[model samples]
Target: MPTVRSVTDATFVDQVLLADGLVLVDFWAAWCKPCRAMAPVVEQFAAANRSRITVVKLNVDENRETSETYGITTIPTLRAFRGGREVASIVGALPRKALETRLRGVLGRGAAQGPID
Candidate 1:
């Protein structure tokens, strides 16, 4: 199943910014409780929206440049990019429904479930 993948500063451009469609990036750290809490939801969302979106994770500790460039002052920051441009962002821990709502809003209609790649 398609799921979240780990990304680093070096690969941020090609893996995210230059990607074709919607890409949800989870900027997190190992020690962050909220980030850990949201992991599974992100995975499930990725699996469900495999065709519409690509999900990825970036560890702040390991990728300082990317984090700093994005001005990620908080862990668990979820940034959504579409067509090589950042479109939305969310910070902190949120429930599954709320996360889904946010993603749906960003995705803008067309509710269909497809197996992730």
Candidate 2:
């Protein structure tokens, strides 16, 4: 089973931005209802796309610096990074199809062609 790894301030750069491959980072807070609701969706999405992408969670409460740097005012902000640059972002809880569409666009048809290299 796939799980969202909690990232902290200390490891933010290495875990998210500096990482290779497509990194989907979810910026959220524990107290936020929307964030809580989106957790399962993210996990499921990660499980399905484990070979194509890297999904992670960053707690705004614990990683204030990164949250502020990213200008993440929302409780649940999802960002997709490729080659250390942010390529796309979405806020709020989105349905599975919508999330897949966005990810597919980022990963490209090459992703569906075969398992991630």
Candidate 3:
């Protein structure tokens, strides 16, 4: 089953920005309650959409350079990137259905469920 991998300032470019397709990066920190609350949902979403997108987590506290570059002042900022550019972003902790709807709106119907990879 697919799982949300961790990305850092050192690996962000290769693992996300330069990745082949869609990549959903969850920017968060250990002290963030909302981030913790949204973890399971992110995990499930990643597993369900494994074949369509790559999911990863970046800890803001540990990855300051990447966080500052992205201007991520909020916890649980979800950014969708493709072709080395960010296409969409969502701030804060949204419910599962809300997250799906928002992502679908930006990503289109192709964001449908896929086999775990």
Candidate 4:
């Protein structure tokens, strides 16, 4: 099955900010149990929407710069970005249904445009 990919502080701009579609960024840490618990839900979402949306996970412990830039105060925070700016954010380890609802909201906001490099 398809899965969420990992992005580092160095790659965040190219991988997410400049991406061509909706991107769900999962802020997480290796030692956080909630982060681990939500991993599968993210991957499943990614797999199901592989053609329309992109899912990426950023390790907060390792990518402190990106995490701080995004003001991530909690693990498992899910942020939706399109056209170089953040459109929505959810902080916490939400269940699959809740996450899906968030994705639907993000997708419903219409299409994104232009390259954001």
Candidate 5:
């Protein structure tokens, strides 16, 4: 099953920013084909990394404020946050292996142990 949850502008701060550990926010809209195609990939990644990260989805069309704040000009943007700040971001749909690799590269080792390096 997919472990990803949805967050809105009203909940973005408490859910993603003030959140503990690492949080991966998927900024996407329903109409975007790439975003839809990436859903399963993201869900699988989330399930596999459940112990290390918290995954959530935010629809750009529904939450414009948060999207604008994050300077998201494109869809399917995946952002990783740690210590209430963005530590990494990927701006397009990627395969599971690539996604994991990219995130691991940016987050580095001991990612779940503490703040992102």
Candidate 6:
């Protein structure tokens, strides 16, 4: 199974922001119902697009600093990073096809054929 690496405040820079390629950072909290609902969709999306993008989870409750830095006022927020910069973001729990379409638009169809690096 594909694992969603937990990103903390300390490692946020190295693991998500500073990383190259397309990185999808899911900002979530344990108690949020929407966050919980989006978990499986995010997981499956991560697995399916493992070669096109890097999917990571950041717990808002645990990574307060990072959450504040990103201005994540929502429970489930998805941000796309490329070249150490945020290129796009989506808030709320969307369906699988919608999520895939968004990712494909950001990463491109050709990215699916190659490694995530």
Off by over 4 Å in 5: 106-117
Per-residue lDDT of candidate 5, residues 39-62 (tens digit): 999999999989889999999999
- Residues 3-110 of candidate 6 have per-residue lDDT tens digits of 678889999889887886788999999999999999999999988888878999999999899899989998799998876677678889998898887666677733
Best by lDDT, which number?
Answer: 5
Model 2, which residues run further than 4 Å from truth? 109-117
Query: If scored against the real structure, what TM-score would every candidate get?
Result: 0.88, 0.87, 0.89, 0.89, 0.90, 0.88
List lDDT for all candidates, in order: 0.85, 0.82, 0.86, 0.84, 0.88, 0.83
The count of residue-pair clashes in candidate 3 stands at 0
Better of 2 and 3 by TM-score: 3
CA shift of 100, model 2, Å: 0.9
Number of backbone collisions per candidate: 0, 0, 0, 0, 0, 0
Encode model 4's per-residue lDDT on 1-117: one tens digit a residue: 347889999999999999997888999998999999999888888887788788999999999999999888888898888978888888888888888886676775665532221
Clashing pairs in 5: none
Residue 20 lDDT in candidate 4: 90
TM-score quality measure for candidate 3: 0.89
Q: Look at candidate 6 and give me any clashing residue pairs.
A: none
The digit string of per-residue lDDT tens for model 1 on 1-117 reads 448899999999999988877889999999999999999989888887888888999999999999999999998999988766677788998887888887776675332433221
